[model samples]
Target chain A: MVSTSILPLQLDNVSFEVRGVRLIKDMSLSFPAGPRTAIIGPNGAGKSLFLRLCHGLLKPTSGVISWATTEDLNPSDAQAMVFQRPVMLRRSVAANIDYALKLRRIERSERIHRIDQVLGRAGLHRLKSQPARTLSFGEQQKLALARAWALKPQILFLDEPTASLDPAATHAVEEIIDAIHAEGAHIILTTHDLGQARRLSDEVIFLHRGRMLERTPSPEFFTQPRNDLAQAFVRGELLWWNLGKDNRKNKLKQSN
Target chain B: MNEFSKAVAVAFQLVLGLDHQLIEIVSLSLQISVLAVIIAAFIGLPLGAAIALFRFPGRMAIVVFFNAFMGLPPVVVGLITYLLLSRSGTLGTLGLLFTPTAMIIAQVILVTPIIAALTRQLIEDLWIEYEDQLRSLGAGPGRAITALLWDGRFSLTTAILAGFGRASAEVGAVMIVGGNIDHVTRVMTTAIALEVSKGDLALALGLGIVLLTLSVSVNGAAFLINETARRRQS
Candidate 1:
């Protein structure tokens, strides 16, 4: 399914506005085929909005978003998303995954095989018969991921997948994410947790006030940010204020 | 003994002996209400689902109209059906007036709006929770609606029962349309009304007991089904 035309999904001058407030401003970005990219920003910085726009859940107000794929292959069929709160159908865990596979028109035999594979992979085989809503919060999240993975999409967009989980549950979900990434799907996620961004992402896009201020390798972005806002953000300093007196003095000296 | 006490004694004898007139009246009532509910469901379920899922101009007005129609007075429906089926009236050629068919038509008119309005409320709420997930999975509007309707089957059943309750207890529409013809179109509610006016209080009280039992059973069955669904879900 590797087609040369489909690689490097592109967004050019994408902007989204609600009412009159700009949520994502004139932004052009592209995601390559295989990187796990994390979008990190403070609250209301448009991280989730940007992810939704790229995932085709929301249309951009101004520019073009495209997957340059072969004509026979629809991009949506090859892509999937998991929301932060992990929406599940009012059915059994197995039925939820089966529903997704059925939407793709996978044969019943293949669906049965894939369902078992994903359920066991997500450590949810034991709860296959249980209604999804009856599962705990963490299990619901796991089921959501399992459901998405069952589709075997080429790109997976997750909006704050682990934001609501406890630490132990968070660790479990991270491990599942790592397994998915290792299996060769491009993963893009949004999060405010800096440590999680550093741990899970190879590339980091730091957004501030609805603008992409910096995009760099995760380690370099955390260690030495080129933008002041990103630098302040990484240092755990208050974003609206100067870092400290010493840093302010250094900034003045540099300006002179 | 007072006339009321004497009537009560006759009512008990009629019930215990399973009087044929009482049984016939009860059976016809069940048949008409059940058939009316079935017909209403065929029309109302999809109508409600479409109204809930789709967005168009005048949709809210349509919704409000259905909601208002839920409380439609049975007599008004009876009058309308009566006019339509009357000789020289529209649909007069069918000669359905003073027949069970006309009675069924009136009940359908009364029950449909109730079922459709309740269905809209239930399916709309489910849609809010399931929309994003189904869309992401590439489900179109039809499939999404079907999935919700199936998952909400228990609630939809309750809506149908509510329609049945409305149809079974209604006297005005069926009375005007069916003409309450004995042994032909007479049902429990219409018979009770006729018997009471004629001062045959014994038969009226008998039919009343049967009607009460039927209503209670329908409601009890709905409650049991709802409890089963809730338990299975939990």
Candidate 2:
């Protein structure tokens, strides 16, 4: 396996526009491997779009993304992403993991072994025969993580894996994510949970309204954010003028 | 008054006696319709998937044409087939102007678009939900379409059976192109028309019952399949 670490990732002047509205502006950054980097920002901060660009799901109108690779990138097999909502196939839990394994042409016995390993790791082995959609919301998120874990990608991009899960499920998912990182997979995740960022992230990429505000180490970012937008966002202050006090109090629990 | 009573009484006898001709027509109609549906599915499903997954010039026009084709007048299609296969027409050399094959061709043309367009609509709606996830998973264009089509098999089955139901019940195109030749191209729908015209209510009504039964079966099967899909999706 070639190390995605060798060259890391470079995005130069990356921009994405939809119907004359810029979603991601002249953004340029290099994402080095081997860190649990959390991307955080306001609702429309283009954090999700930036993650999509990193996953090669979106093409920039005018920028370049280059990877440093020791050997061939294969590009196809080197990455996996779990969307905010688990994008489940209309299949059984076991079949879902098998489908991912089949993509790389793993032998059937090895595929079965891998499925058992990941499902047990995520504590979903008991529900392996059940249809994936039948699982509770939290369980589905766990299965999604298990599916991605089974892929063993060089880069795992997760867009808010715990956004909609319950507390126990969230804790369980975080543990699995930590376990995956321990096995040496670099993780790039996006979230609005400040506490989660504080707990898991090695670095933070602070974005606001389609532009990078600040990219700093996690401890430094939480203690003293340099960008006004990042600072306000960290304190649960209003980014948009219309945010009512009640809505903020209800939805904005400072994470970590 | 007497004629009406006779018709009704004979209709009962036809039901009780298992009339061979009426049964033959009903069975043949099922055979042709089933075969046509199978063939149409083989062709229409992939064609619909291709149209939805790929972009090229004239794609909109093709979709528009298929949508329009869903409501095509059976008589007009019959007339076109008649003209093409009639003596001194373009295809007169084959001498298939009034045959079961001609009837199958006409029904195939009438129903293929219905199957294709319905499949296209089902896939198009699902694509809205799955497209982003699929692209992000590095599912190239071909694999994405294949996955979507396979995922949507339940709805596709309904579309195909709908086409089959329409093909079996349709009369005008088969009547004209098949010439309703006795013991040959005669199918349930055309035979129904013939027997009704000749005051042979017994056979016509018996065949009509079989046709109704088939329609009911198709609807029941579709409901079951749909329920299964719903359970899985939920």
TM-score, one value per model: 0.93, 0.91
Alpha-carbon interface RMSD for all candidates, in angstroms = 1.3, 2.0
- Model 2 TM-score (2 dp): 0.91
Question: On residues A5-77, what C-alpha lDDT tens digit does candidate 2 reach at each position?
Answer: 4337788999999988999999998877687899998788898898888788888887897777557446557
Instruction: Indicate the worst ten consecutive residues by lDDT in candidate 1 chain A.
Output: A236-245
Off by over 4 Å in 1: A1-5, A238-256
The DockQ-derived docking category for candidate 1 is medium
**What is the DockQ for all candidates, taken in turn?**
0.64, 0.51
**Candidate 1 residues A1-256, lDDT tens each?**
5664355789999889999899999899898888899998788889988888888878999999999777677888888899999877778999999989999889999999999999999999999999998999999998999898899878889899998799999998888888888887899999878989999999999887678999999889989988776786787765444256577657646643
What fraction of correct interface contacts does each candidate retain?
0.60, 0.46
Task: Put down candidate 2 lDDT per residue, B56-100, tens digits, no spaces.
Answer: 999999999999998888888888989988998898888988887
Highest-lDDT candidate: 1
Model 1 agreement with the true structure over B95-160: per-residue lDDT tens digits: 999988899999999999999999999999988888877888998677787788888887898889
The lDDT, on a scale of 0 to 1, for candidate 1 is 0.89
Task: Tell me the chain A TM-score of model 2.
Answer: 0.90
Provide the global lDDT of candidate 2 against the true structure: 0.83
